[model samples]
Target: MPYDLKHVFASLPQMERGQSKVISGDPKGNNFLYTNGKCVIIRNIENPQIADVYTEHVHPVQVAKYAPSGFYIASGDSTGKVRIWDTTQKEHILKFEYQPLSGKVMDISWTEDSKRLAVVGDGREKFASVFLWDTGSSVGELTGHSKHINSVDIRQKRPYRIATASDDTTAGFFEGPPFKFKFTIREHNQFINCVRFSPDGTHFATAGADGQIFLYDGTKGELVRALGGEKAHSGGIYSISWSPDSSQLISASGDRTVKLWDVGSGSAVTTFSMGSGVNDQQLGCLWQNDHLLSVSLSGNINYLDKNQPTKPLRVIKGHTKSIHCLTVHKGDGRSYIYSGSSDGNITRWDSDLGLTECFSGKGHTNQVSSMCVNESEELVTCSMDDTVRFTATGGQEYSGDVVKMDSQPKSVSASGALTLAVCIGQIVLLKDKRKVFSSDSLDFEPEVGALQPGGAVAAVGDAEGKIHLYSVHGSSLAPEGPLLEARGKLTALGFSPDGAFLAALDDQKVLTVFTVADNYSVKGHFYGHHAKPVTLCWSPDSEHIATGGMDMNVIVWDVNDEDKRIKMPDCHRLHHVSGLAWIDAHTLVTTSHDSTVKQWTLTY
Candidate 1:
């Protein structure tokens, strides 16, 4: 176990969230954007990125606030989905799906006692609600808004007062059990995007699309004074966060800038501008102690300290895992990728920022056979446990039930949003179900070894010397299908570049090509390689095919010329090849069962 890894790129800072940005559903809340798609949620300043990633909304529409106890977080999304989860384990303890009309969820706030959460979003029947986190029970009602509610704040040391802002150009103050609307102040002409109460519960502030910032007395809910006028922000203000000392407030805006305001005097203290470009539109901001964190739509998370202005301390990248069989989304990303190991752990990688987050928060019971990304971006991984489990992008776990499989999964592929898993010898299709594809008998007893996708054709190779090719009529695999038969157990199969031919490699070290259609006619047989072939891959252009064999050599074949097969020199190669993939015409990637994945710069 000599330090297992062969090579590593850079040593990433082990922050709490592993380089994922946490975006707010409300465009006005502070969006924590990281370059690599990793983020940590922290408060009080010393360790802002150490807090666990707690929630994810459908459209990322609202702000998530940590309860006073720091044990739970209340999060809301654009679809009116609100979830409260535990902080330590990051488990979903409560879920509220309010259905009616979906509007942007602007903000969520926790009461002083950490018992009730005030949730505000765009809705027709209601604009906001006060709910108990433990049981999903309603505690109070939301009132006094003629239009969409934009922000909410509850006094932590309260006389139990709540404040909110709205697009209807007003801020509302309320009092509770059946929290009734107390007062409404019509002051701004534009949408109010953010409102927050100070830590001492003495005062509050509101910022809006009108480029106005106002201060109010938290206890009486009286307008203290206007901090800035139309000249305050060049564009609409999106988010505001209070500093830990309750002395400063930071605001982010579409103007591509972040402003730190002195709360007491109602004046601008300092300004941090990224640029005037549209890509730098600051959608959200947060004061994590001594540092300010802001997010832009272009996926840039800016970290600015009160003292330093030159460089960001760190940046995270993220890519969502492309839905696959037997995979779980671990951290977070916009683009998705999937990684499978022989031991069965399948980690989802966010391609948006190029970071690999753990697949599932919960450990897999067995080797993962296949995985798929559902329409909801939830990763579903099927393992030998005869079960399928669903995990979110942040590694949040959902209860998984066992699916009775006739045998272990051999090959699995997902198309048209459905997962097709071939286990033992049966081909089963599952759509939003774990047990939907289990069958007593369906096809030849063969273990699926390879899967190839091209146009309307999907090819699956099994252990029993058979290749099943089916036409995709709609979503279902054509009932009448069996594209071709191979000479030996089909170890590898792939479609040629133009979809004109199919290639299959057997354990007997033979490569065979056949026409994709017309009864799958044999095109040619190319023999003369190692004693055994293990893996095969085609370049991005499909002009070249590369194969790795047990003889520990990589052979590059000229697909256009059968007479010229080039065996690249292995004088520089040392590892036993287990996996092969061509990255580009001039680059290749390979992995070995010896626990190593390597990239090679092709000379030819």
Candidate 2:
């Protein structure tokens, strides 16, 4: 008796990004933070692979300071959606949606008491507003700026002061819950990027695109002095941070440099130049305890601890595809990886083990669709859901209870610590039993054909003859559409043993190989045997490639020698071989539409 079944994978503890336990202090200068393109990430640091207390969000653009209690965080996104989530549980506790004018929220801040939060962004009615953190209630009205706000900061002491920087080239100062407008200071000729309060709450500083730095008495809002201008940075200054003693300030700029300035003398003390003159253009910076965390325009989060030199202590990475599978390796605390296609192929990978292993199995009944690889390397496939089954290297099968799907599962991928299943034309994400991120219109609506995930990259093939690539960054995710444009329908996709090469197939009966770091290309195409390739695989050494197609043949091609081709001479003489897998450098496996799985030995 066969039936469709949905099983609950055990739940592990959830982690929030920016949680104290995850990023207790700033990392050494060489480390960079990874984001899931939404709001989640693993914090790799001096410790041993800790995966807890990281940020999680749906449609979030940016998150604010941790409240004094450290129990929650205020996050805002491009849709003008603001949410307050429990830091420990990674759950959204409160939400504030302002779709009318919600552009990208540039920054958010919390007062010392943690009772109030301020959100500033590009909006229609108003550019900024102050609100209560616990409730979606407005506490103060935003005034003064006629342009987009770039940054905001709340004084964490008595006589609470809120300061905002804007593209209008001015800094606006206001007071509390009734947030009355104090006075506007015209200090910079360009946009002010950031404002910060000293730890003692006595003073603050502002850095702007004009390359100018200004310091003022926190209590008076009166200008104390202007330090550096055009001579300070060859480019715009994007973010600023303060030291514990309040004796010095650190500013990151578009010029690819970080400068430490002495408050009293208002002079540069030490300067650190990012390597190779790449000019990464640091855009965001934060000071936690004695360490400094800075964000670059290219989505890199850098940790700088003035005490260390050689390299960063750690680097965290993530992705945005609707996670379809997750396998945490036992014993060694390692994990392997696999993802299904939008059309119907399954790719296996060695993730946590530090090696690339892609196993191409008999494709899904429909499109090599949805899949899950457990600790045992047994992959469960869920296609149109008319049938649920498990597939292994030799095409082994486990009868799974069938649960019919309302629509074909177009794209299946995984993120965070969960697997996600996506239905066509739907934005809602099904996380086994829970629902995660979603949107109104995903813009592109092609039947997903193939999928694969590893090393911060998720590849999904679509009916539009395109393969989309997504890069997972901590909390800031974006999709690179049509990474590989095919001349025909992309039927399958895979990664080489080292993950350096991405393999793809099209209805044209061609096998295409690409460098994952770049675009899809002709690594080597199996043109000798198959008329229309249905599936492909890379040998264990990554030096050879195997392919199966409608021509009823299983062919192996030596990637290093394009002139030679190996053929099993109609291994499935009566039917098309629908799947293929390279078991080792000298052996392989195959499955045919004729409902047969065969083992084959590859001779030189």
**Candidate that scores best on lDDT:** 1
Give the TM-score comparing model 1 with the true structure, all chains together.
Answer: 0.51
lDDT of 1 at 95: 42
Among these predictions, the greatest TM-score belongs to: 2
lDDT of each: 0.59, 0.57
Note the clash tally of each candidate: 48, 42
TM-score of 2: 0.51
Tens digits of per-residue lDDT, candidate 2, 177-248, equal 668789998978987878878877788888888788899889889999876634567667877888878888
Clashes of 2: 42
| Tens digits of lDDT, candidate 1, 515-598 | 756667887777766657766766667677777766766676767676656565441133345556553466555444322233
Candidate RMSDs in order: 17.8, 19.6
Cα displacement (angstroms), candidate 1, residue 258, comes to 0.4
